[model samples]
Target: MTGVQKLENSKRNKIQAYDLAIHDWYQFILGYPPHLVRHYIEKFGVSKYDIVFDPFCGTGTTPVEALKNGISSYGLEANPIATFASKVKTYTDYDPDLLLEYLAYIRRSMESSYSNYGIVEPQADLFSYKARFCTIKVKDIINLTESQLQVIPKGFISPKPLLKVLIIKEIIRSIENKDARDFFLLALAKFIVKEAGNVRFGPEVGRTKPKSDIESIHSFTTIAEIMINDVQKTKLTGQAQIMQGDARSLDKYMTRELVRGINCVITSPPYPNEKDYTRSTRLESVLLDFIRNKRELRGIKENLLRSNSRNVFVSDNDSRYISSFSSITSIAQEVENRRLALNKTSGFERHYNKIILHYFGGLYRHLKTLRPYLARNCKLAYVVGDQMSFFRVLIPTAELLGEIAESLGYRIKEIELWRTRAATATKMQINENVLILEKK
Candidate 1:
């Protein structure tokens, strides 16, 4: 089947089996699939000489895909854990044999540690049945700081599973090699979310019934082996540079050589919705030490586009950037009117209207700030979804983004239909589109 036909028939968001190498190692719950990146690369006629940039490079989907196709890429991300994941996923220099040796050492360490503590090794069948059969006491395990404990949402990870995670985490950190240590940590992060933690994602991060004990070591080893296989098969022909920083002012992270060096762009920035985006990774972020305290967490949120009420602050002035756009202001006003009519007086309810303005305003600054770094006629694709999250008010994200890009001297190439998803609030199908643009 043709590429267009395949995209039309296939589920656009799912990671296909063929594209599951480094991408499956770590990913955002809502990130676009690697095939979508390939589609844009081919559509834009990208080559090894070109550099693909993803400003909101959540978990390095764009960069990893670009590197796999022998194309150089650059990425910028605000979330620390996501940045770490991106760096680890795109790194191709790790020795798989060394990785195996490290895995062996980690296994030995875990086994010895458990044996010394008189704790029986958790059986594979126990994890398979999702049973709470283990007799491990939470008080006996190593604990995180009160600050760290406070950051993780309550019940997101039960005490027993958290203890197992902390135990494996200490073992992984003891690896002398930084690269191997990071690789093992990434595997553990996956294990924390998918295997050990009570967190589940049905498009939103929430808690499930807690598991008393999990086969933490066995599960982590399996995850590490999968990563090792991907690393072993990797044949990198191009380089990737990933930076952890706000996308609104990405120039700060750009080196002199990268000025106007970007040839194409493909990314999915955070949509304007109620989803915090941070909560989805809170379990691993806190356990892995990416976010250690409330202050550090707030700092990370400050760097992101203020798309939700949780991240919006009183001092924010991003909304002022697009104040002249009547279309945007009108929508914000409508949202406020709807909130008032509904008698919604909560603090977060008050920020609902402001999120609309600040969200687009942040994107406007992002586009304007990114102008000088784009090569002449550089093609770009922003995979954005429409939202009815705030009082069921429709926010045409791709269309507004297209207008903002045009205002910043980018030519709108097309607003292609990527897919459609059901709005969580209204349960109505909303269009998720790719706003294509070219540098003027």
Candidate 2:
């Protein structure tokens, strides 16, 4: 079979057991599968002597996959929570039995404390203002400060379950083993999104069925058990240099000497689909203290690539980077023209064109900055989806990004169709492409 045929077959088949190790610890809502990363790793000829870099490593899939193959890698993530998760998931050397023991101790302590405090499960009431107003005492549990509470959506987490989660977090914090504690937190973050929080993702951030109460300890322990099993089976080796910083300024985080050794890059950056990447991880981010206030949340959003109108700020000037590209400018103008003809003038609707420009511009800047870091003949695969979110104006993301890279003197190897998704408005299947490039 051809390499692409094998990759497509892997995606079609069921997820394998070996693929579910640390890679499944706490993934993004719509992250590419580990087999995809492995396909590119093999195709790029990565080895322990070479280095792979993922500039927008959300949840660390590339790093985990690279480390699993014993390849030295580097991952740069803008989100603090995601950066922490990637680092913990890639780092090894913890005994599975010890991790399980720590989980047992934490669960026991949390349950004992809950029993002592006489904390009962809150009733699920859809319209009980009284129940909502009722505050549970958390003197024995770790209570969130007013600022932290303000950042979380009111109905997403009920009071009783929130208290239990806080207690479990405190237990995780008390662990002396740094690696164990970090792994525990990553598991907790996953449990919070999957089981604890009332949020649901139809691949977008929205409320589904409200969860009034959850057995936080049970949920946390269940995920931890899965993690321990994965640890026991997987022998993690190789170095992963992780950083939390902006991708546009690649040189700031990766030194010139380090960049000269980078041989390959396999990453899936945010597409211009109008989906705010920040909102998908908002609940866990706030609960885990990665974002404590509006200011911090705003700061995090600012560092991200400007792909959505929600994150566009007055200070954004990334469009200047792509000002010379007539095709990008015309695309942005067409989006604005379409919006004006449709008479859609909501705040976000007005900036659809600007979002496209800035999205490509930010990507252009990253590519230009990245040019200095890539070694000669380094192969890079960027997985991006064609977007039609802005009023059915089809955005050929992969093609445009390839153009930007070519303009920077890189060789465009080929654009491969990775997958397809049906666009709701346009009723057309948009392709998610793998744009392969090689440094000259």
Who wins the TM-score comparison?
1
- TM-score for all models, in order of appearance: 0.95, 0.93
lDDT per residue (tens digit) for residues 1-440 in model 2: 44445645336323456688888888887677777777888887888888889999998988898988898889999999999999988887878888877876776666556665675433312222221112223554556778877877767776666767777777777788989988898888998888888888775788767777776655676789988989898976788889999998887898654656689999988999888888888888988889889899899999999999999998999999899999889989999999999999899999899999999999998998888788889999999999999988889999999999999989999998887778867769789899999998
Which RMSD values do the candidates have, in order?
A: 4.2, 5.7
lDDT of 1 by residue, 98-159 (tens): 88888777776666556555657655222332211222234544578899889889998876
- TM-score, predicted candidate 1 vs. hidden true structure: 0.95
Clashing pairs for predicted structure model 2, backbone only: none
Best by lDDT: 1
- Residue pairs clashing in model 1 are none
